[model samples]
Target chain A: MTAPFKGYLRADGRKGIRNVVAVAYLVECAHHVARQIVQKSDDMDVHLIGFPGCYPNDYAFKVMSAVTTHPNVGGVLLISLGCESFNRERLKSAIEASGRPCEVLVIQNSGGTLSTIQKGREAVERLKAIAAETPVVDMDVSELVIGTICGGSDGTSGITANPAVGRAFDWFGAQGAACVFEETGELVGCETIMASRAITPELGAALEACVQKAEAYYTVMGYGSFAPGNAEGGLTTQEEKSMGAYSKSGAAPICGILQPGDIPPTGGLYLLDVVPDGEPRFGFPNISDNAEIVELIACGSHVTLFTTGRGSVVGSAISPVIKVCANPDTYRKLSEDMDIDAGKIMEGRATLDAVGQEIIDSVLATAAGQRTKSEAMGHQEFILTYKAFDPLGPACLPLKRA
Target chain B: MPEALILLHPTDNVLVCRETIAPGTVATIDGEAVTITQPIEVGHKVARVDLRPGDKILKYGAPIGSMTKDTPRGGHVHMHNMQSDYIPSHTRNASGGAA
Candidate 1:
């Protein structure tokens, strides 16, 4: 029998792998002050994360609130530029009502940048001391929500790291943990194969529709999902790349389709429809890997499994990311950034199942609070671009209990 | 080890190099020794037989691209000699100047 792991339980009834106090700046003007506070706090758990947009966006507000109240965040310190459009009072109230400590430091009212930094530092120190006392409870694998993403992909990505993640996804799903795989734009060619793996016909249709939305969005953006570097790395077409990327979803039947902020109703496989609904208002669905990581965190993923063939080093603000290297040569060059070597598959040394088990073990270890390579290296890469998403249609959430 | 190069699909006329092959390296296919004249990177491909221009470069049993110039037996195949037959890619103007 596996030993039960201890997890930090938040007031919102969610479990987190780490307890962190987030210092968030409301706009770009207050960003420097927030960074200073986090730096002065000298606490690894005290992290700086913020939105740079001065223009108010409802999606940004929702994501910020969700992150502030996330299970991983033990407390929050909001920094505002005083003239920004974000409603700091409501944000503070939401954090306070969640039973977590929160403080707002307005640069204009707090005597400018230096003074505000001093005050913000004091607030963070106090929050850290309080958060240090939060209790940890016993948790099981079934309660874990894991998200998977592939970046810096090459020809070997699908054959190795992706399929390995798929194997882990299957194991996690079987163990009752919710698993999410994203980048519908990357899943263009595998639509039929992906739909066939859905648990129900309705879910199958939803999966197809999400892919269609991604294809339409990218088409308007004037590019196939295929990238030039992808060709340089030996990937030929969009569909071929899709086949490789789709392998990360594992072989489990997709139980539901989720938009950017929609949380999964239960433990099962979910396809995150990252494309915005209707006409593409946002320039691109996801500007980069970090954007997708933010969306996964908003959907309640406690940890993320990132697969790469060309190599990527990124960790999110609210969750830890486990990097799986797919290319043997790239792994040699970036060994420190990677958590697992699925390249053994290419070397003819390890089978896909063996690497898959390794990924599952890594997930359990990460959930038990083991810091991933990216997390330990202080790689808190976060990005939130502008995108419009209509509420999920009824067909998208057929599995949810009404 | 199966071979220095393996055809991933039956219809493929090109074979992916399983390991690095230097210029003048001799490799056997179907029990025949074929001498290479150009170095090929691992994961890159080489024409299995003489190929004419406009012929599809098949790998993994699919058309990866089309040969821009005629390639000889055991010749290295890459961007310098092959081009994508799908949507033509360009650096300055990808979508015909549509921003």
Candidate 2:
């Protein structure tokens, strides 16, 4: 008795909610060329995404590969400056082997800026035609991977948007869909309670240790996880904020901990440990909300649940972000940018369960190709920064076969 | 209807201004009309009673930060006169800062 949702089927037997052609710039140098190609194409499915770093990084390589191979991407066009550190050949081969059409245009080799833009535009047009030929298939909710993140947080974020997302997460997990939540740095005080929900004893310890690592890293930076604006917004302590933010994970048993590029082995609840594996090489784990979203997409999320009290307006390159507004006033002011109004819980207009159901409905609708506010407004924010990670500990992925 | 500025706990000496309070505006709390001496931005807090320096700034029934200078009753409480107790945040340090 449920309505059927339609999805695009990729050649690798994966289902995609959105069939998008990803135009990627290998480094910051080629960003303009990539942008010009997307702009000239004027296609809704053509999205622009890339790394801005001139230096090569393992994390960047992994993220780029994961994004290009994401189910949502129907094709990929790599814009290289010819001298950048990103492995363009390997990336092209990976996308090609995945049965998606891929093209590489080195700016230096393709004459100069004007000539390269012409060639890139031609390549994109060709890819667009090929991307249109991908097959459409019926998809079920069970095959979906959803990620949750909170930004521009205020006191209401935990009380409203966070819990509402938790409700949706619970529903998704019950339906056998994988739900992921990250930012161990933000979950400092609630680690003990969170670890208790781990499905296995080893996963529980790994959960605790990840939070400890975030605490240590933040301390070295001479700051607590708490921000000044958070204090101004009625949050008293770092742990208190953590307690509020942690609610977005819902009450599901933790399945395993995944790093930035590590995909979930099976469908269930997963925790992403975004902090670097060794000493902090990058200045901060996530410089902004878009960076975390990029990591979630790299982990193969089809869509993202973004909760905010201060009102963040960002959509992803490969995945659609559903914005849940936490504050009633903010929702009224920025309703154009938000998808769901969670402030109803505080105003006594709606119950948490009702809001949760609303989020679940939104997810299903979005999976069936509903455009979120950010997506409608064309907020394709993307960012990838340098990070080091030791592989997930054995305890982190208990489901992995020996 | 305008939302009420709630005091999360009875032990808390300060209350959050859930909505913006303009300069010279009067707000009623517990049926008492308290006149605002300065503007208090939404999400910021106001002292329910006069407090000396070092008194814990409470919201949600917990110590959020500490008062740097004496704050009068119904006065705006923010960064210029408040400081975090857990870790002191630095701004524009000339030396030993990020290069």
Question: What is the total number of backbone clashes in candidate 1?
Answer: 0
**Model 2 over residues A1-402: C-alpha lDDT tens digits?**
346688878888877899899999998999999999888888878999998888878888999999998999999999999998889999999899888999999999999888988998899888888888888888888889999998877777877789889988998898888999999888876778899999998899999999989988877766665555566565555665676689899998999999987888888899998888777767878888899999999998999999988888889888999999988888999999999999877676887899999999999999989898899888888998898887777899988777
Q: What is the Cα-based lDDT of residue B87 in candidate 1?
A: 36
List where candidate 2 sits over 4 angstroms from the true fold: A224-228, B1-99
Q: Identify the leading candidate in terms of lDDT.
A: 2
DockQ of every candidate structure? 0.23, 0.21
User: Over 4 Å off in model 1, which ranges?
Assistant: B2-17, B23-39, B45-99
Interface RMSD of 1: 3.7
TM-score of every model?
Answer: 0.89, 0.86
Rate residue A50 of model 1 by lDDT: 89
Report the C-alpha lDDT of model 1 over A42-145, residue by residue, as the tens digit: 77778888888888877788778878887888999999999999899999998999889999999999999899999998898888888887789999998888
Best by TM-score: 1
